[model samples]
Target chain A: MAASSRRDGGAAGRAKAERSAWVLLTPMCLLMAVAFILPVGLFLLYSFYRFRGGRLEETFTLETYWRFMTDELYLITIYDTLQLAVLATLLCLVISYPLAYAMWRMRSPGLQKLIAFIVFAPVLVSVVVRSYGWTVVLADQGPVNFILTRLGLTSGPVSLVYNMTGTVISLAHVFLPFVVFPILASMLRLDPTLREAAEDLGASWWKTFRSITLPLTLPGVVAGAQICFTLSLGSFVTPAILGGGRVLVLPIQIYTATSDINWPVAAVGGLCLLVMAFIAVVAFGRLSQYSEAV
Target chain B: MAARIARAGRLPAWRHLALGIFTVAAVVFILAPLVIVILTSFSAQSYAIFPPEGYSLRWYANLAAQTTFYVAALRSLILALVATAASLVIGTMTAYALVRYRPRGHSALKAIFLSPVVLPKMVLGVAVFMLVIKIGFYGSSWNLVLTHTLICVPFVIAIVAASLANFDWSLQEAALDLGSKPLPTFLKVILPQISVSVFISGLLAFVTSFDQVETTMFLMRPGESTLPIEMFLYLQRWQDPTIAALSSVLIVFAIFLLVMTSLVLGRRKITTLQTSAEPQP
Candidate 1:
């Protein structure tokens, strides 16, 4: 009886220790729960709230959702947001691919290291600084316009700053590193034997690249695009600064709405951005599967 | 082979020259604007110009004259430090739990934990703003700390978990069989192995938390803003060389951080090349 009692005591002690472990985890878990989960969940709920008379009505109505569907302005904003994100993401990928490839193909390790630093150094700097820099570069009197006009490319320096072109160019610059690194990682991870085999089969350099290298790195391309698209969709700072009051992405629209005390519309807009990002993630996951199959 | 070598030598003559030119152009695209900002910081005039009429240190001097900038910079520094320390402790603990303990439904819980990465920060800002207003914690520094904590936790978890996943757990078993206490076992055994990851993630969190703009924009009251929010708002009303001056200061600060971290990290390379530095479990 004493033996059984002692065994039962040990079991209880183990259970108590496990409970203590969970108890120790409580603060952080609570921090995440309260600050992250609750706020975002509440925001999702707030999208259903009714905005009336320049005030927020905390209700369960789907009026905001219905309004978003019926409203042309909202639809247009959504369309513009999608178009901007897609174009920016594509532009980033196109530039990053060659840059990453060049970095990958370099025989000299020192050069590779240098290129990597140059690619990623801007990320450590503030986005605001980079955006401000682009504003100067793409400005009417900036070096770019000066060169364009000097080359007789145009009759005058074109209106580049405070426009969509500037925003897209700046954003592409902003997200370039995110795309480049992932592709480089995949390129480095590429099995050398396959490339060697392609060479062994007497395939030319271009053919080897097309058949062996490109397919292997498609996953990286998809991964990079996913990051760029999702990030661009939610970007607030660049569009606000470089957009110069002309470009209107969802994040800016949401910001404006929230400032106006239009909680429902802001929430709905954020929801759309969130949904668009989610779809991109899902779509990329699917595309990666197809790439793997090939 | 000689023919191929000849072709390779000649190939560098034109095509590779073009390639090198393109690469240099890309680098210029990345670097020139930053160079302009740094150069403009030394301008004699208030307005931006590529070739400054003359050079002066006045803007940097002017930045020193702003008391508000100093206070805001200090506050942001302290706040980011607090958040970094807070997230490091919690994040390491949580990552350990997720890794060591085979708790049920860990993956789903992890996904939930990391959802902040995907959830738009503006949405987060507005939501937290409304929630705080309702909960009566609207203007508190804790709100900022909490929000930044949420923002930074995923990064910490990702880095630490990646490191811990690579760790050989048999070492833990060896420590335990030798009769070490769990707490001591963790500190003396586990920490040194993953210290690199912890420090890197902590560095990243500090920078990210310190650099927040849009989220902190609404969170702070007008006079009581953080540094980045202060600068962001200041930029709206002004386009003077003051910002260029401030940016140059920020550039110096970033350089200081890089130097400090390099000293701290020692042999570990700063570039985040491999997400996991060590081999995976």
Candidate 2:
């Protein structure tokens, strides 16, 4: 009888705990439902409505999707968005890997900490400020152009700003910290013995890094790439400030469509960005899983 | 280990030299834009040029003469503070429950809560804009507050949950057994333990909210823009050094935050070491 009663008491306590948990979670759930889920749902729904004759029409149709599928301009924008995202992600990986490796291999803790701070301090500044800075640095007669001219790399100031080059450079800079920390963390988490073992087996430094370090850190690389790709796909401020109205990425297109009061086009453009980000996320998730298994 | 590696001579000296040079170049690349902005802010010319021909504080004076930035800054400050306070309270409760109870479908619920992190800010901006307009709540500060809180709460939940997962619940039980009320016990015992995480998360939430532009862009009424939105628009229209001046001020603010965070974290580390040295009960 005593044992049965104790079990019953345990069950009752668990039930009470569950009830309290629900009580605690209620506000957040309500907020998410009303503020996040509902808005996103409405956004998706807006994609089906029609926009014609310079106004939004309250009707259900696939006209927006059809246009996106068939229109050459929209197609080019989609292609450009993907291209930019891929290029920026690749650039970030290339730059961040060597830097992260250097940081990880550093012997001095103080130096490592200072380097980390330098890498991360940019996050606190506004993206607008950073993009504006890039505009100046990449502009004609700017520092980069001045260097090129002084070195006789170019006869005149090359057009770097107001184009894809400027956009990619700035995006890569913005996403650098995001890329570095993940790779650095993975490098730190690696079993130090693996490198030592490879070295003991008379492996060259390059060979050991290739066989041991690189393989283990592939997951971090993929994770960082995932973040950079998604962020670049949806980037607005960098492209807007640096693109000089020449870069026609999806986010910029959406912004234009919305300001033109073309809700359907805006919705469709946003959906394209969303779908692309989702695909990248899933692909990287699979890659990370495979890397872990290896 | 590095010494051993050096002795082994498997790696060529040139390789190290190459890496060191590349690292310095990369750091320069990272810092160049920021340095340029600060330098341009001091330029006498209106246009941004390399190696400014002359220097003056004209842009700083121009920035001070503008009333719009001050108003926008004040608005951003209030909104961020309110949003941070609300998210911290709500997020702490959610994280506590998720960590302690391990209720059914907890992972699913947690993921749903954190889903906003993956959603693009521009998309969220349009989506919430649509909702607010439809509901006739356009231009309301409450709309901005609620939306900012939504974006910030996920970060708070993630940070607070990580800290709470490491919490020793025994102290809470002991407090309860001593006939202390649950709220008071939580305040005295639980909060002190996780205060660092709370403080860090709160700071992060404030920064995220304050620096928000894409989402705040659509939600804000015309002429009532946040500081970032104002700067963004101003940059779009002009390339003068006045924006650079404002940016320098923001950079100084960011540096202040960095210093404050380091101090707090440094103190926390020392306290943790001291606690570890204390005799157990």
Candidate 3:
């Protein structure tokens, strides 16, 4: 009889704890519902409304979506946005892989830490500052052009800024830390015994790296690529400063549409960007799963 | 055998040399822009040019005369502080509850909280802008604060929850068994353990909020902007060295933050090492 009563008391205490958990969660849930969920829902709703004569019309029309699908200008912008994102992701992976490999191979922890700090230090600075810095660095008479001219690679200054080339380069730079850290983390997590076994079997260094290290770190590559792609898709500051009016990506299109009071276009353009980001995320998620299974 | 295998796995000296050169080049690429910005800030000329025609402090003087940046900086500092404090409190509570009890659909709840990280800041800006206009809360600082808190809470929850998951619950139980109340037990025991995560998250939250431009742009009243927004607009109008001067100042501030973070992390590492070395009860 005593044991049964004590069991009942334990169940009561657990019930109380559960109740308190709900109470703790209520504020966060309420805040998210009010500030996040409602706003996003409203934004999505606006995408269906019509924009005519320089104003928004509250009619339930698919005109914006239809136009977005059919318009050549919008199609070109989407193409450019995707091209930029893909190129940036590829570039980030290319640059970060070697760097991550080097960091992983470092014998000294102190040197590794210092190198990691150097790699991550840029993240603390504002994107605007970084973008502005790139504009000067890649300008016609800037240091890069100066070097190229001096090296006789080109007789005159080359136009690196105010174009897709500059945008991609700057975006890649902005996302390098994000790419490097994940790859480095996965490299650290790798089992050394596997590599040793591969070597003991008379595999060359290159062979072991190719068959063992590369395949195991594929998840990190996918993860980093996903981040770079998604971030590049919505990147505004770098492209805005570096593109100098030539790079008409979707985020810029949305900003312009909003500034022009074309709310419907803005809303539709934003949704397109969101859709692209979502697709990249989902594709990379599957890739990572496959890589991990390998 | 292991030593032989390791030796065999090591790369040739030439390969290491090549990689070392590549690493140096990568670091240069990563740091070139920042280095140029600082160099440009010291340039006397109006245009950004290589080798900076001549050096002067005139741009710094120009930055000093611009009162707008000062006001914006102050506003950003306060806003970030308030947002960080609020998010830390609310986020810690939610993280504690989620980590301890793990109520039904906990993963879903966590996902909902962290979904903002994936949402484009531009979209969030416009969405909240529309909401504020519709609700007649336009030009309100409170709206900005609340939105910032919403944006920041996800980070805090992610960090704090991770720390809380690894917490030893037996200490709390022991305190409870000694007749201590739950609130005091949490304040005295649970908090001290997770405090480092809290501090790191708070710093991250502050930096994120302080550097925000996309979200803060749509919300701020005309003529009143955050430092980043101010600098962004300034850059749009002029590509002069004054902005570079301002950026240099901000870079110095970032360095300060970096030092602080390293100190905190270093101290925590030492403390953990010491604790692990001590004999357990």
Candidate 4:
């Protein structure tokens, strides 16, 4: 009888706990449903709706997607978006790996902390401000151009800003801290003894790094790359400010379409970005798993 | 062992020199724009010219004269504070429930909660804009506050849950056994222990909300822009050094935040990156 009562008490406690859990979760669920899920669903629905003469018709159709697939304009926009993300992510990785490796290999704690702090400092500032700063820094007669001219690398100032080059450079700068921290985290979590063992085995530093450290930290690289790609894919501000109307990516298209009240076009363009971001996330997830397995 | 290897100079001296040079170059690349902005703010020229022919505080004076930025800065500040507070409260409850109760489908539920972090903010912005338009809640400040909260709550939940994962349940149990209620038990026994995490999360959430441009852009009504939006629109119209001055002030604010975060984080500075730095054992 006593054991049975104890079991009954346990069941009652669990029931109460479940009730409390639901209560705590109620606000978040409501917020997501009302704000996030509902809105995204509406976006999906709008993609199927037709926009006739700047008016949104509630009837469902796949006209927008068909147009997106067939139109060279949209096809180019999608291609450019992917290209921008790819280039920015590549730039981030190229810069971050060496920087993270240096941070990991540093013997001085003070210098390491300073470097980490410096890398992270930009993240705190607004992207708009940073993009604007880049424009000035890379402008004609700006420091970069001034230096290049002085060095006789170019007889004339280069048109760096107001172009795809500026957009990619600024995007890479904006996402640099995000990429570096992940790689650095993985390096910090690395097993030191493994490296010592490799060294004792008379393995060269490069060989040990290639055989072990690189593979182990590949997951971090993948994770960082995922962040950079997704952020670049959705980045509207830096590209808007730095792209100088010359680089027309999907986000810019969506913004223009939305402003024009062309809901179908906006929805279609947004869906493309979502699909791209999702693909990158999945691809990176696979790479991270593969790296771990190896 | 790793430090010992580095100290014993297992690598060639040239490699160290190369790494040192690369690090310096990377730092320059990272800081060039920011430093240049501060320098340009003091430029005497009407247009931005590097290594200015002369220096003056004219731009700072011009920035002070622009009242639009002042209003927008105030709006951004209040909005960020409200969003941060709301997210902290809602997120703490959610984290506590998941950690303490171990509810069914806990991992799945957690994933759903964090899904917003991965969802493009631009999409979220457009989606929320459509919803508000549908519900006729367009032009409401609550819309911005709620959307910002949605974006920030994930960071709060992630950090608070991580902190709570390490919390001693014995204290809460003891408090309950002593006839204390759940809310009071949490307040007295749990909150103090996780206060640091809570503060860090709040700080981070504030920054995230304050820096929001992609998400807040569509929701804002005409002439009621946030600070970043105002700056963005202003840049679209002009490329003068007045913006450089405002950006300098913001850069100073960022430095202050960096210092505050470092002081709070102390030795476990890794926690600042804990949102993504969940080191697998």
Candidate 5:
């Protein structure tokens, strides 16, 4: 009986220890609740508020949703937003494919490291600085246009900034590292045996790439594209700086609404951006599944 | 067969040249604006002219002479430090609980913690600003610090959790069995192994907090700004050589960061530095 009582005491001690462990976890749980979960929750709720006469009504309504659905201006913002994200992702993919391929092909780890470093170095610098740098490069008298004019590629320096071209180019450049790493990860995971088998079967290099390499690495490409799209969708600083006020993406719209103190409109714009980003995430998930299943 | 061989040989050569040029041009393109800013800083006159009429360092001297930038710099640094400390505490605790406590709903908890990674900072800024105003907690440095910590926690949790995953739990078990207190066991055994991740995440947290502009923009009471905000305001007001001088300083700051990164990560694998901290399984 005494031995059985001691055994019960042992179980009780174990339970007590775990209870203390739960106690230790309290700070973290509290923080996430207050800081992360609460802010986002409170933030999202403003979307349902009415902003009549520049004053936000505390009462909840779906009028903002209706406005978002019915308003042509909001619809145009959505269209422009998707177009920007898609173009940015496509450009990033085109740039990253060769870059990642070269990194993967090199046998020397040292060379790989150096190339990777160069690609990622810009991320350490401020995005504002990088964007500012592009404004100079894309300016009419900037080095890019200067070189083009001297080389007779253009009659004069064409307008780059305050338009879609500069925005896409810089956005792609800014996101190049994000895209490259995912694709490179996928490429590195490719089985060398498959390529060798293709070559042995009398397939040419291009044929091997098309049949074996491309399809195998398609998952990574999709993932990289997904990241680029979502990031570009939420990107505010780059478009603001390079777009020179011509670009009217959702983030900028949200910012303007906030500045104008129209919480309902800003909230609605933010929700729309959030929804688009959510869609991109969902689409990316589907693409990954399809790629893997294929 | 001869035609096929010729086509194959020529194609690789062309592709190689094309790829090489593309690579070089892209790097140059990425670095060009920064280079131009450096050059413009040395201009004798007060305009953004490339290949300046003559070279001088007057703007840089003027940059050194600005007091507001100094204050803003200090504020940014302090705010980042406070936020980093806050995140490390919360993230470390959360990572421990999520990993070690055998908790139900771990995944949901993690998703909540990490949601800000995809959350637009501008939206959060607007929302928080409104909420704070609504709650009558408007325009305090505490508000900025708290909001910034929320954004910064996900990065810390990610890195620290990964490092913890790599840690040998048996050692932790051994310590616990040998009658070490849980906190001390974590401190003496687990933390040392995961210190590298903690340090990296801390640096990242510092940088993210310091470099924030858009989120902090609305939060800044007029004339009280972070360095990036200050630089942004200065840029908006004037595009003169003085701004170039300030940018050159920022370029130096970038170089300083690079050197610091190498010193910290030189012994570590290149792949680890390039990769974002892996999500904890």
Candidate 6:
């Protein structure tokens, strides 16, 4: 009889703990419901609403999605957005890999910490500030032009700012720290003994890096790339400040549409952006899994 | 440097030299924009000219005279603080629940919570704007705070969860057995251990919210733009050094934050940085 009562008390305690867990989770659930689910639902709802001339019709239709798919201007905007994201992500990888390799190879703890700090310090600064900084640095009379002119690479100032070159370069810079850290983290997780074994078996440094280190860190590369790609895909400030009224990516298009009170167009553009980001994330997730398996 | 090369294994000397040169180039690439902006802030000429002919404090004086920026900066500060505080509280509760209880489908619930991290900020921004307008809450400050909290809570949850995963629950049980209440036991036992992660998450969340532009733009009135929006708009009209001056101030502020972070993390020397980055299993 005592053992039966004890078992009943244990079951009651387990149930109580579960209740407390739900109680703890209540605020988060409510916040997500009110702020996240509701807003995203309304956003999705607007995409189905019809917009004629200057008025919005509270009706369900696929007109916006159809237009987004059929419109030539939007088709080009989508292409340009993808191009920008891909270019920026590639540039980030190219720069971050070597930098991370150097950090990983460093024997001095002080140097490692300093390098890490330098890479990450930019995160604290506003993106607007960083993007603006890029404009000046890449400007006609900026240091880049100054160096090129002095070196006789060009006879006069080259037009770098307010163009795709400037936009991609700035985006790469903005996301570099993010790209670097993940790669560095993966590098730090490498087994020193594996490299030592490769060395013992007469493998060259480059060969070992290619066969062992690079493949092992490919998951990190994918994670970092995912972040860089998604961020660049939806980037507004840098492209706007640096695009100089020329780059017509989807985010810019959405902003313009919203300003013009074309909610359908804006909503559709946002949905396209969302879909593209989701696709990239899933692709990267697959790539990450494959790399881990390798 | 030679020692570093020697430690890097049997790489050739020329290869090491190449790596060293490339590292210097990469550092320059990272720091050039920031250095140029700081230098430009002192330029006597309004337009950016590398290696300025003369220097002056004119832009700093000009920045001081702009009341709009002052107000916007203040607004951003308060908004970031509120968002950070709210996210920390909500995130901690959720994280503790997930960690301690190991609720069913907990991984799925965690993913749902962290889905915002992958969701494009621009989409979230537009969605929230539509929701607020639809519900006639467009002018309310809580909307902005709530949206920012939503953005920031993921970082807190991710970081705090990772830290809590390593926490010893036996201490909590011991305290409870000693006749302490759950709240006090958590406060006295669990919080002190995870304080460092909490602090780092709070700092990160604050920075994320403060630097928000695409997310906060449509939510605010034209005259009540955040510091970043104000700077963005100002840059569109003018290419002057006044912005450089303001950017320099922000850079200094960033340096201050970096210093504080190092000081705190220096004591702990935890690999929590990596954990914060890849909090998901």
- In order of appearance, the predictions have TM-scores of 0.91, 0.94, 0.94, 0.95, 0.90, 0.96
Candidate 1 C-alpha lDDT tens digits along A154-240: 998888788889989999998888788778888888998897677667787678889999999998888788878887888888888
**Number of the predicted model whose lDDT against the real structure is largest:** 4
**Fnat (0 to 1) per candidate:** 0.40, 0.63, 0.58, 0.69, 0.44, 0.67
Q: Taking the tens digit of each residue's C-alpha lDDT, what string does model 6 give over A44-151?
A: 889999899799998999988898899899999999899999999999999999998988887677777788778888888998999999999999989999999999
lDDT tens digits, residue span B1-281, model 6 = 56445556456778768777888899999998999999999999989988898999999999999999999999999999999999999999999999887667888999999888777788888888988888788978988999999989998999999889878777776787799998998899999999989998999899999999988989998799889999999998998999999999999999999899988887443245665553432
How far out, in Å, is residue B160 in model 6? 0.8
| TM-score, predicted candidate 2 vs. hidden true structure | 0.94
Score residue A267 of candidate 6 by CA lDDT. 88
Better of 2 and 6 by TM-score: 6
Which docking band does candidate 6 fall into?
A: medium
Where is model 1 more than 4 Å wrong at Cα?
A1-25, B1-15, B261-272, B276-281
Q: Once superposed on the true structure, which residue ranges of model 5 sit more than 4 Å away at CA?
A: A1-24, A58-61, B1-14, B277-281
Instruction: List the candidate 4 regions with Cα displacement exceeding 4 Å.
Output: A1-9, B1-10, B269-281
Chain A TM-scores, candidates in order: 0.91, 0.95, 0.94, 0.95, 0.90, 0.95
Instruction: Please rank every candidate by DockQ, starting with the best.
Output: 6, 4, 2, 3, 5, 1
Which structure is stronger by TM-score: 1 or 4? 4
* iRMSD, all candidates: 5.1, 7.1, 6.9, 3.7, 4.4, 3.4
User: Candidate 4 residues A63-162, lDDT tens each?
Assistant: 9899999999999999989999999999999999999999998989889989988988887898888999999999997999999998999999999998
Q: What is the overall TM-score of model 3 with all chains considered together?
A: 0.94
Q: Write the per-residue lDDT of candidate 4 for residues B227-261, one digit (tens) a residue.
A: 99999999999888999999999999999998898
Q: Model 3: how far is A49 from its true place, Å? A: 1.2
Q: Check candidate 5 and list the clashing pairs.
A: none
DockQ of each: 0.42, 0.44, 0.43, 0.58, 0.43, 0.58
